[model samples]
Target: MQGENTSVERGIFIVLEGTDRSGKTLQSHNIYEYLTAKGRKCVKINFPDRSTSLGKTLDGYLKKSIKLAPEVSHLLFTANRWELHDYIKTNLQNGVDVVCDRYSFSGIAYSSGAIKLDFEWCKSREEGLISPDVVIFLDVNLGLSSGRSGFGGEIYENIQDQSNVYKAYQKFTNYSFWHSVNASQDPNVSL
Candidate 1:
């Protein structure tokens, strides 16, 4: 749906990236509902999709059931995104908006936090992948996140790792297209 004087000329790719437990899942659903109620064609997708083979492997690793070298684990993370590359592109080509939860940003952020993985090295795996038209990073203090529900379901869910992820997330602030929304406030503050 387009406003009288506004337009979405084509498909819009909007991605939400944040440290673990930043309320992204909840916010993304709300955004999807708001857009749909306004009659916009949209679909929500999540990374490490967990439905594909690579995603399954990543899931196991995150669950701490599978072991991998830092480099290989991070590459699997990138490959998980690659698995959905064409699906995302096709949605955009068809004029359906994509509301994605996570992307290469998460891949590099989480992976590079490890001493063994280079930031640029993690990025190299995602070269040529589709870029989002907009990236909304939910910035929140790890201290604030510690109080949220479901905080420790995965391996990287702890405060120490989340703090490091926050540091990595900050690096993207230099990019004009990256929008950091302070998410420590009540979830409905802006809605």
Candidate 2:
């Protein structure tokens, strides 16, 4: 017993990406539940983790309660992710699978897609972060999304901005670990 290895295997990092009303939050929860039901240790985390200071600022910007330049907002978003980098890594290393509602991809997508920032520049900020073992992009039709509830509640929820963001997400689809699913289906259906 003294020589037995006690270290547990690192957990998988899973991220869900998509436009507004694309059901990322719902699916992230579903995935977490599925893993837990299967007896896997899992934790679900959402980006811009609004409880944090940086996230609070990002929240104000999102809610139109405050204003920030495109570049400044972009930096803040990246910083928000950085704020939780250690937490994410620690959990993964402890063998707790992470199911994220959103991650850095949304940073690149929203900044570049909605604000016309350089795609490469937006992506550069995410270079040193923990990479996801799998990224699920919930693809939803913009028109269909418009009819969904709470479609325009936030700054980037508008059709034009979402269309741009969708386009940006397309650029990353070719990544081998990225998977796109049709989110237009009824919620009763399993992903």
Candidate 3:
């Protein structure tokens, strides 16, 4: 036991982000299942949780039933993640790896891409949060994604908006923690 540290290993934070219908939810679950099958503790979570009051507001906004300024809506999305910061941290500290379907990346990409918000400003709002260990950017063809079920149900589901968001997501591709995947392929394809 001489050089073996007796410390517990902290769990990693993995985020799956992409345009709507790009299989983020599916991939997140897949990662969680893979980890669990390997006997590692894992859990899946998603952004715009839609369970809290703020999330309710966000849900309304997404559904087009409530209107908010571009900046306000972006901040609301950030706040939804902020509200869950402690929970995520506690779980990681307890050795439960987290697979988040969408996180701050989606917020910044959507607001800046679709509404022309300042990318830096949108990114700054996410400062000080638990950074993801890796961000799996699901790069899929928007044309292909558009054909998926429930593709046009939300406000940003249109081609033009998704196109913008897709471009915005490209900005992060250069980051060291970012990983791009060809999501246009079958979901069963290994990542």
Measured against the true structure, the TM-scores of the candidates, in listed sequence, are 0.91, 0.97, 0.95
Candidate 2 residue lDDT tens string, 1-191: 89999999999999999999888888999999999999999999998799999999989999999999999999999999999999899999999999998899999999999999999999997899999999999998899888888878789989999999999999998899999999999745668
For model 3, the superposed segments whose C-alpha errors exceed 4 Å read 1-6, 188-190
What is the descending lDDT order? 3, 2, 1
Cα lDDT, all candidates: 0.85, 0.92, 0.93
Candidate 1: residue 165 Cα off by (Å): 1.0
Per-candidate Cα RMSD to the true structure, in Å, reads: 4.1, 1.0, 2.0
lDDT of 3: 0.93
Tens-place lDDT per residue, model 1, 13-110, is 98899998887888888888888998989999998899998988999999989989888898888888888888889888878889998989998999
The deviation in Å at residue 105 for candidate 2 is: 0.5
